[model samples]
Target: MPIVHHRKPSLLSFPMWLGTRVLLRPTLSLWPLNKAGMAGLFLIDRAFAAGPKPSGVVRERMTLDGRPVELIMPSGPSRRDSETAILYLHGGAFVVCGLGSHRSMASRLSKETGLPVFSLEYRQLPQFGVGTSVADAVGAYRELVGERGYRRVIVAGDSAGGFLAGKVVEAAAQEGLPRPVAFVGISPMLDLDVGTNPDRSSRSDAYIPQNKVRELTPLLDRGPVPLQGTRRIRELADDAFPPTVVITAEGELLEPDAIALVETLDDADVDAVAHSYSWQVHAFPVLTARHPETLHAIEVTAAFIAQAIREAKDADDRKDQRAG
Candidate 1:
């Protein structure tokens, strides 16, 4: 008999869907506006974010290579002998959002994984560009893995932060730094050239306007030409990348980017997997309260991290046995 797979229904039911369409989508539609307009929207988000914060974690403020970062630790007992840690990068279109705004997600991740999460507050555009953000992220990774003696690191990020996570790994490969054991990209904005496809504009999530890609392209571009022309993952060697998980929402505009990234990684012979939701919002895993799909995604991510670390250790044990 042929195998039959049964997929679970989404938690993004009628009420949440209606709320996204009515309130969230309209607010995100203003992302492509002028600086003052964007600032106003950001301020509004900040104002509304004054509610109770997530608990079950301890937050420690610190500076890594001059950039501010928060180290989040699960409140209960955790693996003490493991040198593995997670480096989390927050997403804000390379323009907005920061450590404070993304604390809830970071804390939740820490609680679920029972691992320390170092959330980096990388600099953004208008004052910084792709180069600076990548630099900050790489610097933080070095501080944690290189200087701090972390043997295994899982690099994870959301949206624009997802892009940064990939870039940092690629940069580390070029610089001969130790590779991360795994990578988790949540609703990543992988391709800056996504705007070239006019059809994608219509398919984008209601919250993310297609034109916003064009508007932010120039600001994020650091090369002589545009960022669209720059080589992203193609520059890495076949074995340079680690196992990766790319998550996306089918309704999101950047779903194509996530699919393309997974395909690219597969072509390079890297272990890459793509998990998609049929009706969730972009970066749904970062929702303030854990949605059913969000919980499922987080569980998937935690499992991937655990499996990757275990596999690496097993491989090392085999190598040691051979040496002996």
Candidate 2:
């Protein structure tokens, strides 16, 4: 299915839904709080948000072009090999979050995908702009695939990271680098222009403050406000894209982003699918543990990755046979 909707509301998600509506949304809406204050709030939230440290996984610290990256690997036999891996970019609106903040999701993804995951601590706003972040991501991917010789790399991310992931694929294709086998964008912030339009469909989104997002745009990129548009992906040809999957929540602020991206990919004749769930907040897949829907989403993502890898390998095998 191109667009799957799971409208079953989960009681487990109620607290998060309520908290977003009453606490986080209002706090972010307060534009009076300067960048420092907003950043301070994010740091405070990161301090308290502890994710599970699952056992039997190895966490290694490494530096990619002077940027910090955490590599997560499962101890047991996984579906991974020297030629296959995952590169994960963490989401923080191009400001907050890092290896520490997103380690839980990386660990979980490693466990689920049976592949080592390189969680990039890319540069963010106020210090670096959108160009730097994209450069960092593309550089890391080159290191992994070109230098490390990983043949089946999957790029995955959530929120801002999701947007970065999609952009990485586009850039990689344009640069004639080794293409990723697939990509997964979980509630990506695709439309930088959404903040410009006052009549956004998700004005009442429970978690994200639309006005605050607009205010933060100038801080994210140096060259131009709204550095990227949602339709930029449309410029990529069908052959430039790999199988892609986008997961979004029903009432989340960026739901329209997910829809628009999928439609764009479809227009390019790229194999794209989207899953929308009811009563789930933004980045719900990584924000919660043991939520039935969260687990289901992970399973679905894992399956998609696995299928993409298989198809890639099969295509390679066919090419080899033809050459022989």
Candidate 3:
């Protein structure tokens, strides 16, 4: 749960700064995230899909839990196991950036971890709220781990998807479901209350705005939201709350959220790692090779996942031997 540092040389500092600070920040902060905003997000997805795609990955579409699921398989010797998978939740404030914009990152994770990456297309804003999205995410996890028989799947996401990933584990615990092997929040919005705090105005965030908090936060209350009337970090660190690795850009709005998660998990004696990098955009890892920081974050996340799978498999092996 400590802040780790990396010194990899980056060549895209000026370009990334220009992209996030000048282009994404002003537009995302000022844009009215209404129904029309939903359309705008879709347009962004279309533009992103029209661009170049990641190579050496096999993409397939399917339905899990009756919702859309994009399974990205890395077509290389890197794929070592099909018994485990990575259930990735994309971060787009729970409104935009679906399978299209995030497939590259999912592919990167698949390649790095040697696990098939299932990018879930959960319900989002405009037509759906955060609660509905939570329902979809939790349902998808249940389907994968319960029905699909993937005992060591990793739940990971960025931005709002990170938010959903957290809710999924909490609900899984409450519902008597087996917990995920681990959790990874890539600059996730873990606390919905972070949207309401006026003190955050002094924080140096790249794109997300303070005004947009209350606008979407209310949506969290509209669906079958679990763990009511409590801070998420207050319970179940060693139980349903598994080991975690959360990544954030230094001074971004959600950096505190990442730190609070790692700290609480650490205090509970849960294995947790929080890394904050300087001079990077919010959720830069989603850019997938857009920055050296991004690659480092993904590499760390992938390493965490591989380790979790190893431990889980070993534990299962031990249990089987004892039963025999």
- Which residue segments of model 1 deviate by more than 4 Å? 1-8, 31-33, 38-49, 202-204, 222-231, 234-237, 318-324
**Model 2 lDDT at residue 145:** 81
TM-score of 1: 0.87
Q: In candidate 2, what are the lDDT values of residues 126-162, reduced to their tens digit?
A: 6677767877887888888876788879999998898
When 1 and 3 are scored with lDDT, the better candidate is 3
Give lDDT for model 3: 0.78
Off by over 4 Å in 2: 31-35, 38-52, 223-231, 234-239
TM-score between candidate 3 and the true structure:
0.91
The collision pairs in model 2 are none
Better candidate number, 1 or 2, judged by lDDT: 2
Error of 3 at 295 (Å): 1.5
Of candidates 3 and 1, the better by TM-score = 3
Give Cα distance to truth, residue 181, candidate 3, Å. Answer: 0.9
TM-score of each: 0.87, 0.91, 0.91
lDDT, model 1, position 52: 71
Rank order by lDDT, top first? 2, 3, 1
Which has the greatest TM-score? 3
lDDT of predicted model 2: 0.78
lDDT per residue as tens, model 1, 1-324: 011111454545446655776797766656554566545545533753485767889889998878998898988666643688899998878788787778888888888888889999887665567777877888899888777898888999998898778887876776788788898888887765665567576354746767767667766765332232233543442556888887777668887767766777788777777887766677878763557877877888788788888887787789889999
- The lDDT per prediction is 0.74, 0.78, 0.78
